[model samples]
Target: MVGRKPERKSAPPTDVRAHVLASATRLFAARGFDGTSLQAIADEVGVAKPSVLHHFPSKEALRASVLDNMLAHWSEALPRLLLAATAGEGRFDALVGELISFFAADTDRAKLLVREAMDRPDEVRLLLTAQVRPWQTAISEYIRKGQRHDEHFADVDAEAYVLHVINLVIAGLAVFDTFRVLLPDASVAESRARYVTEIIRIAKSSLFAGPALSAEPRDPSLEGAPNRRNGTTR
Candidate 1:
């Protein structure tokens, strides 16, 4: 007797939805939200327009879903890394490294965020209030806590420092495409590493207004086993 052929399994619904969201993120990042359409997202995902609609009813809905996912990841990841660090220097270095990796993973997020800040101020305002503000506030609080505990961090202005750090990270990654072209010899990975190194240097040298920090940079990998700190998983 002949055996039956193995049946091929279809992707799960969640997987399908995730693929669509990933396609939408790429499109929205490159084309801007208004420039990217539902049909385009469907085409990019190789799914029918109705299928895309089933996952995300409208362009705005899709954009919201994408932003929500990005915000959720950053909000959780940043806090976890910060809390995991045993000291202020460690926390600061981890923060810089993570920010570099986050934006470097996709330039679109950086571009989309900067564009939305200018083009759709109200949407940005809502995003900040709902997601970003809380994480940022926590980081600021951590900086302030360091200032209180360590003389070396005495003159650090938590608010200004955080804002400037964000601006530097986002701005660098946003324009990195051009930088890659300009320095064609450098692979994207090489460029990112170099940029992160420079960012770490700046943070260590300029951000603190106190005595000179140790000349050595902290470990870039920020390796640690899974652990808990301040009630957060780290």
Candidate 2:
């Protein structure tokens, strides 16, 4: 008994489920859903295939859970984030900052979304309409309010602008690591800061009527919100 090595304990069920979801997300992002198998996910999570199925009944269910996990975080957090700031430029900064932070906190999220969009446009469209369209409409209405108040640029298409900014943030972050190679002189942190800063700047400048709002920095607190994954607070 003295010479025996201790047995490795298995992860708790909740932790195993979370790990399986997380691993499935990364795998589905790297390889399309059709390409990734339940066995691969199990291997990634260091568990047996039955362990993965214990939580998710099938690969389709796992993929759905993974997508839902990402969207669920946004669904819960977006309203709070929007409410935290006053209207106009405050809301603008809050929205942009949170958007950037959400994806930057885990680029795999961006990759997963992008991959899904590319691989399954119709499915993603339907999912977005159901889950994301309300928020998009709310933000667009806010933009319209700013326009009516003469705070935002006249003639800006509110829906189009919101859609474009969403795409910019997701697409930009999806390829951020690879794109950083173009900025050879800067450290990864510096490059990332510059990258996000420019995005905020561009978003502000294009939307705001005057230069004052465009020059203000985004809410520092929004930038610092803890990274969330698999519907759990971190």
Candidate 3:
């Protein structure tokens, strides 16, 4: 009897690094990098300052990791985006829908990006030039192809158009919570639906030609395209 002891169960290992990054991202998005502190992040994660430092080493390193995480998400999605761009019909819907989802899935992402741009313009500029510019160029070339085929507007400045759409999405989502108040009659969910719908409509209407604007059905090939909203192929 006294020799018998109950076995103790071990708790699952915590992913402290991930928790720290998540807290840092949320805090940085809500309050600018200058306003957020490592101690605050530690508190949010319910860990000691040393635990945060054990993972990130410094506030600057944490900030860079947050940006890197966002960029990693985009990099993973780049292939799908490129495919949608060159896939011809329904390309606008596919491309724009994915873009919206990328940020709208977590508005924090948009806020973080906007804050980064304002807080460290030079750094953001370098990141854009080095990482985003190539994707922009590739997509621009696809737009040019569409123009050549008379599928898109000949006068559309492909580079500028892409850039503006990106800005519209990021900036729109960043402030959407505040902006939704204008639609007083609608619930938050309804307002968001309308907001996203209008963005897609405006983007499509401005970029496409005859058939796309008219009541013509979407291409059969794209009928089976993945539902970007839910991440499922139809």
Candidate 4:
């Protein structure tokens, strides 16, 4: 009896489910939908394949569950974030900050969305309608409010601005690897801070009716820059 070891207790169902979802999220982000399997998810979660299926009936179902859970989280949080933005001095900046922080909190989430959209458009659409589109619609309304009330937003098209902001936040995080390389001198924290500042600055300039924030003249060394998108010189 003295030499016997105490038995280890198994995690409850909720904990196991969360673990499975987390492991699946990481796997799906790193490996495309076709690249990952239920067995691999089971192995990562230290559960039997059947156990995983018990919580999620099939592979598609599991992926949906993961995305649904993430979306549910955002759905709950959005109201509070919007409220904060409304109460803040710089409402637009505050909203952008909240968004940047949200995606930055879970770097894998954006990557997962990007990968899934590219690989499994059908599945992505399901999630987009259920979760993403609602948020976009709400934010679009908020942008419209700013356009009506805020001096900076008065000239901007609410729809186009909403799309630009969403793309900037998601695409920036989705392609952060390239950002890291391009910003070799900055730490991740610095890069994120700088990026957020720049985004907010650009948004304000584009929307807000004000003089340019910087007073310095343009550098004469590069007077004529080529516009890559249209192949024109500026």
TM-score of each: 0.72, 0.78, 0.81, 0.74
Error of 2 at 104 (Å): 1.2
lDDT of 2 at 154: 93
**Runs of candidate 1 exceeding 4 Å displacement:** 1-14, 85-89, 134-157, 209-234
Alpha-carbon error at 11 in model 2, in Å? 6.2
Over 87-174, each residue of candidate 3 has an lDDT whose tens digit, in order, gives: 7667778888888878988998999999988889999999899987997898899789989999788999999998888888999999
Of 2 and 3, the candidate ahead on TM-score is 3
Model 4 Cα lDDT, one tens digit per residue, 29-72: 77767899988887777667788899888899888877777777
Which pairs of residues clash in candidate 4, taking residues 3 or more apart in a chain or in different chains?
152-207, 152-208
lDDT of 1 by residue, 1-234 (tens): 564333333545357789888888888878788888887776666666788889777777888898888887777677655564545535666656677777877788798788788779997888768765776788788777766767336777777777788888887777777776764544777656566566666765665545444443234334351111121121
- For candidate 3, the 10 contiguous residues with the lowest summed lDDT are 4-13
Measured with C-alpha atoms, the lDDT of residue 232 in candidate 4 is 18
Clashes of 4: 2
- Identify the superior model by lDDT, candidate 1 or candidate 2: 2
RMSD of each: 9.0, 7.8, 7.6, 9.1
Each model's total of backbone clashes: 0, 0, 0, 2
> Model 3 off-target regions past 4 Å?
1-13, 86-88, 211-234
Candidate 2 per-residue C-alpha lDDT over 94-145 given as tens digits, one digit per residue, 9 for 90 to 100:
7677888889888888998999899889999998898779878987897899
lDDT of 2 at 97: 79
lDDT of 4: 0.69
Task: Write down the worst ten-residue block by lDDT for model 4.
Answer: 225-234
Candidate 3 yields a Cα-based lDDT of: 0.80
